[model samples]
Target: MVVAVVAAGGPGPLINGFGVDTSCLGYDAHNVAQGDADNTSHNILHTHSNKSRQSSPGKNFPLQNNSIALEIMVNVPKERKTYCAGKCKKHAVHKVTQYKAGKASNFAQGKRRYDSKQMGFGGQTKPVFHKKAKTTRKIVLRLECKKCKTKKQLCLKRTKHFELGQKAAASGHQY
Candidate 1:
């Protein structure tokens, strides 16, 4: 169930109905050259009401206005073939997993001070951030060498959807 969508302008990688060839979604090069923000600069989304025979709207590709749908195939297996520094060789099979943040410590100095300040405060003391711009986070992959067990971290480009392992067949292979 792959959906095919294309933008009107801009130089981007070509993608066929079966697969995506590049990681980039199309964008206006003129706007990008002026240093404008990415998502807020465009609004080219439209739904074709006459195309009722098509499968669910973007069942294969999710669509958003002014934004291009990037059909990146990022589903990686739990193991990978790459160079391992510990073994000092290439073609080493490394175990792959998502990196998770460690638990926050209650005894940290900042936490203690914030806790005391909020105990009898008339209003909130610290500022909370709300003006977030980016829609997706850069995924981090944790790799461990099977032989030496040396661990390493790799960061991927930012994207809206990310999957760790091979998707099940029943899910329609939407990644």
Candidate 2:
């Protein structure tokens, strides 16, 4: 068994494949020695050790489970011009609006079925999913052609917040 010991800012004792005491200068020395031993282990160990040195704190380091506040503000116009597949096959002026989900129906087929199953006292009937992965939903834009009044839906990239139009700019001179 090859036991590799890694420590910060100190000369550490390492136990190699053979059961013997080996003194390593530091991580840099180990990287250099491993690089000379084999090409594969050299590449793997050498590149892996240099990443933390390459990266610093507060420099766009991506966190897997943590939520980051991007604080991004978006500005979109209320109207847009694009090709309409309806009556206007050519480019036409279109009105842009944010799309929203409708309210859940109490009499929907799935809802009715689930309600019927849970009518009697049986604790819980269906499995309630709790493992939510995403924190944001993709924003959908509703585009309506001004000429033909034809509407189409456009999906935007996911974001925490969505804005319809640009906010009013502040005047330079105050009254």
Candidate 3:
């Protein structure tokens, strides 16, 4: 049978046809090679071949299970070339911007109804909603055609941080 060992920065090892992570066994490459190779769920049995092999407590092991704090941000370009269904009706350069809601109008049907109902009210007519559960709002990209000045919006997934064509320089050494 074929036995393929996987380490960090490499794809997971395939025991049979499925890939599996063996780093959770608290064994590094040095101990892994000296121990008996067991492809079944990383239950390794340590058997030193020679007396010269000694475990070093000072050696650092690779981080297991990918427990790293990652910075995730959604960044979109300031300008994009896309289809403009306006006067041009063709692919053109579109100015990219973040979509934001405008001020709510008090003259709206709901607001008008609420305001009229609130007149000489005994108490609050409806229960105020306070159970907020979401942490982030879905981002929307406003695309305006440079030629036709046509505006469109593209919806994106939820993100904590959003940037437009701004790339921060690496502050430290990047691997």
Candidate 4:
């Protein structure tokens, strides 16, 4: 006996062994002959037959958009600890500036010798010295508000600089 399979939706394409055309009686014969086969087979392939929904459109365009230009200023943090006691603030600052030089070696070596002497077992022990590294660029900026007689200092780090740029872009401003 010839069996027919019909889909619930209007006539379109034949999916698997079933067709959607209601004009054909093949679906009715298949349902009567195969019974549960019609239901199980159609459910397995239902997902492939469904159409996808389109995404919603975005909002209206922005107006008065202006490019945001930033001048990043990097500075040392306040309340930082000093390497040695009784050293003048200027000396501390100078040491940080001369970080690239090997001047700090003497101070580091002196501290190590003092520590080893306190331990009382030192004989040609390795000298603990600060390794000379590259110097970082410092930022300086002075910001004044025109509306009020208020002035403020601003410092930007690497992460803060990128965050500022992202904020500008999110606000519909060109960065």
Supply every candidate's count of residue pairs whose N, Cα or C atoms clash at under 3 angstroms.
1, 0, 0, 6
Q: Considering summed lDDT, which 10 consecutive residues are worst modelled in model 1?
A: 14-23
Off by over 4 Å in 1: 1-73, 87-91, 168-175
Model 2 TM: 0.56
Query: Could you give candidate 3's per-residue lDDT for residues 32-151 as a string of tens digits?
Result: 334445642363433333335565643444432122212367778999999999899799999999998999999999999998888894888877999999777788999999998999
* Reference-based lDDT, residue 85, model 4: 26
- Quantify all predictions' global Cα lDDT against the true fold: 0.63, 0.65, 0.69, 0.38
Better of 1 and 3 by lDDT: 3
Q: After superposition, how far is residue 34 of candidate 4 from its true place, in Å?
A: 42
Worst 10 residues of 4 by lDDT: 91-100
The digit string of per-residue lDDT tens for model 2 on 1-175 reads 3344433245533434322222332244345335446533432322222223555565555652233432454456899988899998999999999988899999999999999999989799899999999878777899999999999999876668767877856669868
Candidate 4 per-residue C-alpha lDDT over 1-175 given as tens digits, one digit per residue, 9 for 90 to 100: 2323444434634544545464433244334324566464553322343446554432232321211222333334332223222323221321222112234554687777766676756575566668965344333333333333233444432222322112232356555
Candidate 2 lDDT (Cα, whole model)? Answer: 0.65
In terms of lDDT, model 1 sits at 0.63
TM-score of each: 0.52, 0.56, 0.57, 0.16
Provide the lDDT at 57 for model 3. Answer: 43
RMSD of 1: 18.6
| 46-97: candidate 1 lDDT, tens digit per residue | 2233345657655655554214423454677899988887765666889999
